[model samples]
Target: MVPVNPDVTRFLHDGRLLAMPRRWEHRRVVARWLAHATLPDLLEPLGERELTDRLSELAADPVGARRAMVDLGAVHRTRDGAEYWRTELTEYDELVPDDAVEDATTSEGLHRTLHLDGRRIESVATFYDELDRVFMAGEDRRLRPGLDALDDLLRGGFGAAHGADRVTVVWHAFDRSRDALGFAATREHYLAMLADPRFDAALFRGRLADLEAGRGPTYAELVLEVFADHPGVELLLR
Candidate 1:
């Protein structure tokens, strides 16, 4: 049978089970496709068991797929697990589907998943500013929150800026973020993120050494250099 979504064709290159994509952009596309194909929006708020049963029919990794849907803002669930509903995010528009849920966050349609919000941009100095307070407070608890904001800046503004100004800002933010991540307050989160299949510890350390050696790497260059063209490094912000 033809795949319900053609964007999924790349992963379906094997022409059997839909293999998962390693690239963040492709993974997000596939995630949205799964979210639509499963029709979670059409159902009433489902129990965890019911959702899992439904998802299992759609993918080899039903559980991971569920979490991806949430992260993509395609669905919503109460914290207590008693309820979940299709999200209002209608902004995702890479490959359009007729039955696609019309949630507010939806972007273009069907195939697109990594909706880069122009409004999420921030100056690199903002990262430094947040970390300075955490450093001065002598508290680790404030570390993750500070880093998360920095991650947002990088994600939203990653490719938007260029030239010397962009480089300088990124370098400064990278240094500050490194210090914050290395701190005890946020070390565990940083390490756990390394375990993500996407994060590259070797590339990260090599880039750090290069930066310390006065090599050139604005945030964009550094991430692409170390994270293989994806900001898998930012996943550490969690």
Candidate 2:
């Protein structure tokens, strides 16, 4: 059963409705604005006619305009030649704030574990935590037909590792799934960590399946295996 928290739902609904898409677009524009142009070597101010024309052209046929802009040297293009409004010129440093990076990382981590049910029932505990994030305890499992049986089997609790935080056994039946599951954690960091060569979802599933089948390693062994396979497990297991 997928349980919805009324408070969270209401808050999200209000936030979405109140948010201005245009404001977000403006923010992007401001964040990416360039103080100087590459071509002509003039102190090119942002929003000048030439730049606006270029921006408009780019907006209209973004793919072609981007290529043209790259050729003009007005903007630095990525390896893929996607033009970005030049911010800082440092080669090694990120232009965006560290908090934004952290947030993106947390969001990626949350998304990876979400929507895990349609595939094989590899890690019941892992799958359960993802679901619990969106739904409250005693909530109906929304994705699968055999949820009640699964919930009963799991006894309404699961293991979740908050990012760099202590491990906690969360009751799936609780109302505060967000706090308990670390839903606010940065997904980008989580996903970046998963990029490790040894990280294997297949292996994790295999171990989980073994545990479920009564022929697998103990939970401790499986956890250890996960840690061994993924150095990033420290992020999740901490």
Candidate 3:
């Protein structure tokens, strides 16, 4: 469930923010929320386009939101506007005025856990399905069953994390997932990707060949590779 605090959510409707708050106090709330929500890797600097694209997922006026965050000291950017990073929000906590604003999602110390039962994954399809179900908390919206969707889902700001401070994903029965998504499943996965015009046919063909020779990474390993990009998310394989 999303961490709900009236002080922070008064500016939101559904999941997307309704509007960038106009009042200084109200704006601080929204800015602080964006600082926590938008960036998946706080330590890495993002190009303007990347940062704006991430922000666009949460607000209609991403450009304005970006500017507001910079102005409010919630984010920092290069003078040339080429790169950006989230700023520490500890100083702003005292300015919030409302004690109730300390919600789980915004609390830096709070850590949440999400469990992925690998015992339930029987195939590549079941892997994505179980992932989507667990991450979305059984809500509407099935993931595309592809690496792109997996990246987005793990990045937070929606689904399970929903802007939470930190998330620890435990993949139980991981050995089962490894076997279920092993050689055959990896070959099948690459073959399907090879069929798509958007993918590099040559590269996928090479991967398929490697799989046939019993030398390539399994589908589960690929999932681990993607998880490596998100340092904020701790992935525990059991």
TM-score of each: 0.34, 0.16, 0.52
Candidate that would win on TM-score:
3
User: For residue 222, what is the lDDT in candidate 1?
Assistant: 34
Rank the models by TM-score, top first: 3, 1, 2
Off by over 4 Å in 1: 1-3, 13-19, 40-43, 88-238
By lDDT, is 2 or 3 better? 3
- Candidate 2 residues 163-185, lDDT tens each? 32222121222223223223222
Residue 106, model 1: Cα distance from true site in angstroms: 21
Q: How accurate is candidate 3 locally (lDDT)?
A: 0.73
* lDDT by candidate, in order shown: 0.44, 0.32, 0.73
Let me know the TM-score candidate 3 reaches against the reference structure: 0.52
The whole-model C-alpha lDDT of candidate 2 against the native structure comes to 0.32
| Local accuracy of candidate 3 as per-residue lDDT tens digits, 141-219 | 7788888888998888578766667676767678888999988788888989899999899999998888788788888
